[model samples]
Target: MSLLNDPCATPAELADRCEEAGLDLAAAPTSSDLEAVGAFMAQWRRVVACSEHEPRAATLNALMLEYASAPWLTDHAGTGWHLHFREPDVDVPRQIAALISVGTALHLSGLGMDRLGICAAGECSKAYADISRNGRQRYCSTTCANREAVRRHRATRASATV
Candidate 1:
């Protein structure tokens, strides 16, 4: 959400966010790297836009087919063995695309296809993953939810006064 929603985000910002998410960036990202990932993020948005499960699953499957490699286990850093769905020694953008594609697949399959969506807030098109206990999320954040709630309350009050 942070990366996709920030249209002005730079390569340095992408590097920072990737580190925060525990992604192993082999080197500092370049503008081209960020652009590549941004391109992939656009395709990922198609999955979020689907109102029905079937389309969502199909879009995600296509992304996985394009980005993800066959699953493998590696201890590249000697820390511990971990599963990777991308080719070994891939660059930042390719690595990110592969990870996000496979991760979204695992998430939706484990949860539900409706788990990803665009925020219901009228003014926001931010994408969100519904990982809540009940899987009924409608807004991207509490701020958006509260803003919509306040808008509704004010509209109701004005209509009642009229």
Candidate 2:
């Protein structure tokens, strides 16, 4: 979502964003890495915007096929044998893409594909993953919801006065 909202325009920015997102890169990002990350972000936007389950699943499957390798158990950093969905020694951008694609599939399948959405506020284009208990989230934040409510209230008053 961060990439969709504010895409990294350069290799340096991509490296920074990766670091910020808690990805430990084996080395600094390259131009190829930037291109790969940009492409993945575009695909991610499509996945989040899809309102139906089948299309979203298809997209995720394609992504996994292209970016992910066979799953493996690793304790690369002595972190106690966590599962990695990509092959060893993969580049940073490809690794992140694979992880995200697989994670999205799990999240959607477990939590319902409807949990992913773009905010309903007319002025906002933000994407959200609905983690709420009831899974009925519409707007991205309270501010947007409040703004929409105020607009509705004003419209009601105007209609009554007419």
For candidate 2, the clash count comes to 0
Q: Clashing residue pairs in candidate 2, if any? A: none
TM-scores of all models? 0.92, 0.90
Choose the strongest candidate by lDDT: 1
Tens digits of per-residue lDDT, candidate 1, 84-152, equal 998888888888888888988888889987888899999999989899999999999999999999999
- Candidate 1 lDDT trough over 10 residues, lowest sum: 1-10
C-alpha positional error of residue 106 in candidate 1 after TM-score superposition, expressed in Å? 1.1
RMSD (Å) of each candidate, 1 decimal: 1.5, 1.7
Off by over 4 Å in 1: none
Off by over 4 Å in 2: none
